[model samples]
Target: MADGHHWNIVKIPPIVQELAAGVHEPPSQYMVGEKDRPAIAGSDMPEPIPVVDLSRLFASNGYGNDMVVSEKQILNWCDRDVLREYTVRCREITSLVLKKLAKLLGLSEGYLVDMFDEKAMTYARFNYYPRCPRPDNVFGLKPHSDASVITIVAIDDSVSGLQLLRQGVWYDVPIVPNALLINVGDGIEIMSNGLFKGPGHRVVTNAESERVSLAMFYTLDPEKELEPVPELVDDEKRPRQYVKVKTKDYVTGLFETLARGTRVIDTVKISDNLNEIVS
Candidate 1:
């Protein structure tokens, strides 16, 4: 008899084992573009950012209080060391997630493990535009999909503003208390051979309150070449699309696009020399 639910205890991975075990650091300042940014929501709104506890993310798997992550710590991720530690934790959790997804997809566990090892990870913060006298005039965040493998988000539960693009329509994603939202990033789609999709999403701000979210980005390994898995490619009128790329060069290309403030994925440079993977 199966209850249809799989369970496993989770713990901090060895990559971040040293960092999380070290002394704590002071909180750093966090802000959006400016202090007096115009409002994106209407004047009647309160703060839109919600609160979440990522410390308990693996609690169900028995990691419990042994792993504690504070909201303030995530808010100040300017420290590269802190960001690195957070990224490691992100990959650790995502490894579990990828395994589960692989099982469902009938893919081998080794494949999933390899995918995790070949991935790059990073941590970033999304700050809601500050409250202005007028809300409709401002946009806290524009809709976009992360250009990575997977994205784990610990959002502020008190404020509700994250929306997902579904069937070409925007739908509000309710931020339940104490829950983290897992969204498939572009890389996952490529790895999964398009089985899982990276949907477009965005955040709206409250006229009087600020909204914040911490995003963990997991990327493909820079030394590896990425192409659609043959097993996942089936005949469907859609053409079999594959782009070869080196993960390091791919990421550098991504930063170049970000510097230009462009959201077009097509503009990203893919390495034709993807076969040059180093051992």
Candidate 2:
């Protein structure tokens, strides 16, 4: 994809350490001087939350043939629904995304979750990091990937804090005014036999402002149970690449792995010579 002109990595301000605490820690948490500044909204405060629209989802193709919506539009819709109606819409979108991904990866429509033996759905989470008095001392969030099949993120353009790890370099992701970030998760990777890539991302604190972010996660039901699909394994290809396992077992295993100091997800076995990620 050609990079958008509007997207560019800006240098972090040099004076961030001296003026006030960074965005990671809220100013309300710590008292620095004789008199704490009264909290004021909109005085110079940027809107941390992003505003998204989802009308493009209902659009039909011209003559009902050549019409197709952009990927960003679907992401926007996913983000918007999560912000509005908590979980119902998320589940609907999750089903849709899984269906599309399954078709792309050559699985039966609705068979993606079946292979993993889980009920898939979507969810939205909001994160707001207000400015702090000590910007250099704290971080808004540590780098991590979503525990789901996919994660769609929409960040506030007013204040920047999102960053990504690429080739051992930390690059700030440009927060497009109304655009969304689509990232695949470990589950999709295992299901696709490693076709998609999950992003390694983290958030930082701004010295002068606050940052708001919304992330939509797609996942599977804890009880539906899962197993690796046989179609993904081939004798000519990577046969021992993964293991078959239940969805619930996989989710628990992932958390355990994290606690044990592993960031990248590994394969879990479902059946003989079949492995997959359970997210």
Question: All models: lDDT?
Answer: 0.60, 0.58
Q: Which stretches of candidate 2 lie over 4 Å from their true place?
A: 1-59, 62-93, 108-110, 113-122, 225-227, 249-261, 267-279
lDDT string for model 1 (131-180, tens) is 43334433456556677777888888788677776675566776677677
Against the correct fold, how does model 1 do in TM-score?
Answer: 0.60
User: Candidate 1, which segments miss by more than 4 Å at Cα?
Assistant: 1-89, 126-128, 234-239, 248-279
lDDT of 2 by residue, 20-67 (tens): 343334555343233322212112113333333433443453447341
**What's the true lDDT of residue 18 in model 1?**
50
Error of 1 at 25 (Å): 36
- Candidate 1 lDDT score relative to the true structure: 0.60
